[model samples]
Target chain A: IPPPMRPIPCKPLFFDLAGNHISYPMDEIEEKAGTSKKSPKKEGGGITGLVKGLWGWGGK
Target chain B: MTTPTAAQQKKEQEKQALYVELQKFCQSQDDTRAIKVASKILHLFPNDEVAFKTKIVCHVNRGMFAEALSLINDTSKLSGSVQYEKAYCLYRLQRMEEAKSVLDSWQSNSFKKVELMYQIHYRLDNFESAYDSLSDLLKTSDDEMDDERRTNLSAIAASLKLAGSSRRVKDIQ
Candidate 1:
């Protein structure tokens, strides 16, 4: 892995949620390292664009 | 005492008993019953931490990767040990990049370094490196693993053998 490819370690938000690391895109994350099969579903809202739908209305 | 009131009380008692049993099952390392119990609990209290984690672990163990991933995404109380379990589930699913990202961001040192290296190498099919790194990890670690870790080590060793054989066969072909 190149140094440039290394994701920066920092916490960011996905719309309403807080403390999520917003370094790389979820697709890139899935491509490079892979993802869990039952990933969280995106709620019918905008925040799903952020942390791969880790936060949304459906979670509740 | 009215019969209806008695029946309601019994139902509540049953629910409470089931909840206690679910908690016990969640704490136990036994995946089979734990999964069943957890799933039942989730059917009742979907956000319960123990139940959610147990369900995710069970699904991942069963290779229900898509279900496990969806649950991980949906549940919020799986904030601690459950997160580590989710990471392992991700690895089993072959979502290496997401697995790596989650593992990297995790607060637990347990999933760091060697496992990450091995996972990366495994995803890349760099079997030699994966085996060597895991072997190195066993060599360096001071913690004594009981039956389960030893069993996983055995499996990794066997896979390494198979990987080596296949590589050789490929060369011959």
Candidate 2:
């Protein structure tokens, strides 16, 4: 029987504008996405946590 | 019909000689020399097919993607090969979405097209789709597969394996 499929944890590789291969670290990407070092979960004071803390009553 | 004048005959002979020289340079893979001769030919016959193709190839080999793309744009009634080169230039410029769109529009089944499609899907994070395209390409007769194709197939397969193993390990942990 064929082996069960699994998702790969490989970093995505991209060709730069000059056709050069490049890959970015996941943490650096997440940081750029505003969810790593400064994530609300980490800081416990961002908009995400604030909303969660206030529950749905914070806003519709 | 009147016979050709001596001057016209001489000009035709010179053109033919230039074409022969261009063919030799191209066959030798001396792109720089080929470009020089091709430019001269283009100077005399602005729309010469051989000269145009040679110039575009020289530009591509020199990594002048923007120049190649511009030349392709300036051309009218693009041939299939020219369209393929245009798509290739877009791809090399890291315009993945646009490259994919251009490639999709072409209906021919060619090695370059398959290779480009694999790259586009792989870059889009569609690994399975990428693998599918690659496997389809590999299914062609061995005689038709060149060294580059073989290398690409192996590289992608190895990468897929590594990804799969890492995912499985994470699951186990």
Give the top-scoring candidate (TM-score): 2
Model 2: clashing residue pairs? none
lDDT of 1 at B101: 76
Which 10 consecutive residues of model 1 chain B have the lowest summed lDDT?
B164-173
TM-scores, each model vs. reference: 0.45, 0.60
lDDT of each: 0.52, 0.61
Write model 1 residue lDDT over B10-105, tens digit each, in one string. Answer: 754554556455545444545577677667656765555645655665665566768777777766556454555566566667777777677667
For candidate 1, please provide the TM-score of chain A on its own. 0.18
lDDT of 2 by residue, B77-109 (tens): 444446667777887788888888888998877
- Provide the fnat value for model 2, as a fraction from 0 to 1: 0.00
| C-alpha-based local distance difference test score of model 1 | 0.52
CA displacement after TM-score superposition, residue B162 of candidate 1 (Å): 15
